[model samples]
Target: MTVKTFKQGVFLPHYKKYSEDQPITTIDLPNEVVIPLHQHIGAPCQALVRAGDRVKTGQKIGESAAFVSAAIHASVDGTVTAVEPRPYFTGTNVESVVIEVDPEQKEPVWPEQDLSSLDKDAIKAAIKEAGIVGMGGAAFPTHVKLSASKPIDAVIINACECEPFLTCDHRLLIEATAALVEGARLIRKVVDAPRVYFGVETNKADGIAALKQAIKDDETMEVVMLDVKYPQGSEKQLIKAVMDREVPPGKLPLDVGAIVQNVSTAIAIYEACRYKKPLYERVLTLSGDAAARPGNIRVRVGTPIGHIIEQCGGFKGASGEEARLNKLVGKIIMGGPMTGWAQSRLDIPIVKGTSGILIFSPAMVAKTEHRACVRCGRCVEHCPMFLYPSHIGMYAENGRYDSAVEWGAMDCFECGICVYVCPSNRPIVKFVRETKRHVAAARAAKAK
Candidate 1:
């Protein structure tokens, strides 16, 4: 009966009704896919297969020698058309492998592996080889995360899809409950943890119920209901809410005897360990007011956003006309509204970190130019990280990167809560990003 929660977060409209009841549907393989080599936080992968090479589904197409990088696999049986720079969801050009999907494609048959016999190292190796990353959008290589130096006491499964209009994780809980449970156990074993916790929000009653029923007989796992709050699914906040462990300002969950993985990430880990299947595809919610048909879809990682939009019934205007013709579609976001990137064009392809593709009509999109910080202090009161975003924004705006750093710019995860609550409509997340770039560049220069 005790619903656990973290401190300092904003309450917002769920906006999940559009796709929460919809079942997970698989989209047809896109004709061509642009698989970016740099989808994670670390070093980008080098193209393993050059143009004109034939690749099968689940084949490793890109890899890197860096310990922080995860491999990139071909999501479909296809012929590589090019290995060149392409537009990415981040509004930048990244080297990508473009593949033309073969028409006569068949389901990939992965050799079943004996999951019971795999040890901790074997499990970690399998995860890394499969190219599995944090499917909740952080895109941190999962294997690197499981390599905890500190002893871990528990593993928390983040089922709190707290971002507005995202129901893919909730659907995964209902449809892939068994896989999620198995994946949690695998993660716990890797960290040598004794227990697993599922941190879910109260809004997802069905998902919570399904998880509870699935873990009823398991003593090592339990479901922890979390309050429905924005940014509740963030790594540090989830750890705090579920395990009541505060990860230090510059530390990770493992530092506090816990490891947190998203719901979709857990499912990917299970598939990789049990079937030796690579993480080439994932489930994401396609929903917004402008989307003609909104639903949760299982899609390949490299599918183009344009192709996905057309296949998902295209865009619709307010009066039921084509949105493009009316210029009614204002924004296309690559992830959740809170932390997702605002896309300029639809030519970019979805990557491993993409959690959703949201299309919003002009009427639903707010058009406002960010003004100077009003010093109203709402951003400070509501920030889940409890940092002075106003000061950080002001410092970054004035090109004072060191001052921004002192104001905790590096510690910020850019959840956008500060911007959401800002009365002056100041773009705090943008300032934080700019500050981080400058600080990182300065550090590199100093090291040189």
Candidate 2:
């Protein structure tokens, strides 16, 4: 039982006691759902159904002919009210399919298929057709990983769930252990990989035990226990921790002869291949200091955050006098606190990459004005990628985008460790994001 980990990652509080042990509950369908045209990293999908068109559950409503893009499906049987711009979690408006949920809805039945006879192409086709993506929040299309040009020897299933307060992956491991392992194997077959590794953190002892027992008889599968560290589940860091491989900058895990997939992503792959089911719904954690009820829930893809929050009992102190004035909740984040977006409004709907909805009380949130960098050098010491975040932030702060890139600003994964450890409370991740946006815009202009 050797413990493995990469270097230079911060050790933060787990904060998972609230919902780590809770079983995933299926949430009731909302009155309306908003499915964004682009939920993944690649090209956006075009709407296949217009306003007033009726769509059934699991129906493909949006798709792109691009090889890197994943299709978008309807999560419920309903009529499309609009195919237009709507608010997203990222604080930007995106073209989305708005559907009014049918009152008398029937569950879509997916007849299970015999998975034994499916070949590599068939399995990949199933994954693409199901519109599965990296469910750990990246939302990178899974089929693109399977179509790797480089030879892959090891497939690392990231079960770390290292983000504080998000326990959806931990609950999945403990509850759906067999399905996760089978899904990992299916991914391996698609890539022609020889072995599979489940990289799990030590904090989730129950999940580790469940996975170990499930893979006991399989020689090709093994569970690697990782140290409890922030960003341990990140692709490059996970590869380094599990197989001692380093993915070079500007490259992918496949470059180092490995493929990394999140625990929930693997489970989605299994569901798609075995049951011919699409990824219309997913499990996510709803927890934080301001949440009235903290638990893991299986919700449809297009459900609005406002509806989900109300269904879960609303924010804490909801019935109190302060709640009436909306003074109880200070912040509502769409994912893990460290790396998630700070949502301004609750109307934003959950997409495929959503992993959690965190609500924080005003007392829990630190309202401080960011000051100048004090040059303490804590961000560099704690950054998992070992980049000079202070220098990058300083350069980007002064609109020096070239200098920021020279300092490896593009390599930073926006893990938020810099912001967490900075004494000045500088928003280094935000600065890095601004630098990236400027850089991308410049590149696009140059191309023109």
Candidate 3:
């Protein structure tokens, strides 16, 4: 199983040194939790429980009629305080279920089952029932991803941990190697893929070594090292790097005889299959100058960000003054700097899709005023998808979404490299997403 190289991916500074070596620890439960109903990509789930209702951990609180959507479960046993529009990381107030925690922690009782004798269909059913989704920022339902109309030829496990200052996946690979490997094998069975490969970045030597050791006897599973680069862990980029196959525009990995799953997703699959437990907790990296204890923490879903920061020993300096003293504490981000959202408030809870909580002091975080695109072509040169971002950005800026789509705007992966390297500091990716939404709406109207 020789590793293959892909084209045109930049090696950005991996500030992973902050917590790469730190093992993941669990955060203490907070006084209350804010569980957003629309955490996944599909239609927002309707709330099932009302205020004053007592809900147990893993109880379904929100659900959707759409097959593409996933159910939302209560992360802890508590009394629902409110079910109304609340501030989320998306910069919008969406409907969320607020719960007041009971001082005595309690576990939700799940139905007993024997997964060892179950077939692939049973396994898929269990995963769907567990409300499992990709924890790697995408938040797409894991069951939907594993379900493909066409046959999958190969399965690629993403362990690259490419995002800087985020070592949750790296720690999972090292500490939960057995579960990760077993999960990959289960995915191979579910998708009926003959071959499975785990792709880890070269920077994570320990993770690669651990995974290699875990999968040594399984010839179908191989641990391959990837070049350390921003967005290298992305589905399209990883597929290109590991299999040399390009996922065409408006097409999926299934079109290329491949299926990709994150390491965290694999572990979740294993849990769903083995213990019949729903996804309620995930590894989250809490790092920055503001964090007195910067490291990876296994956080229970729906736990408030404020509690997480408190558990890590609250911010160093007093209120407004803290930002100045902590070089990396200017603003708080919910995921990796490249793909994460800049959060407005720390009151928002950690959702299933949260991979990291990055706090940047004004100095560590770069802030530049927007300037006109010089057409220097650095964005095009660095785009992993080979789409011309400058043209798309220009079209989007001018409100010509149709022209942007014609120029392959939908193909833009939104990796934020264009935003990162732009000398003019233009919000190229943001404009591209807006244009994409416009195109989607127009197409939907036309279809009707």
**In model 1, which range of ten residues has the least summed lDDT?**
316-325
Candidate 1: residue 427 lDDT (0-100) = 91
The RMSD of every model to the true structure, in order and in angstroms, is: 1.5, 1.2, 2.1
lDDT (10s digit) by residue, model 3, range 1-448: 3445567767788888878889888877898989999988888899999999998888888988888888888888899999999888878888999999888887666665665687889988888888888889999998888889798989999998787888899999999999998888889899899999898888888888888888788888887778787788888888888888898878898899999999898998998888888888889898876666789898878887878887887665644345435443677889988888887677888888899988776767778788888999999998888888899999899998888988888888788988888999889888988997898898899999
Judged by lDDT, which candidate is best? 2
Candidate 3 least-lDDT 10 residues: 319-328
Off by over 4 Å in 3: 1-3, 108-113, 319-328, 443-448
Alpha carbon lDDT of each predicted model: 0.91, 0.92, 0.85
Candidate ranking under lDDT, highest first, comes to 2, 1, 3
lDDT of 2 by residue, 271-386 (tens): 99999899999999999998899999999999998888888988887843356377888888999999999987778899889999998889888899999999999998999988
- How many residue pairs collide in each prediction? 0, 0, 6
Per-model TM against the reference: 0.98, 0.98, 0.95
Model 2 clashing-pair count: 0
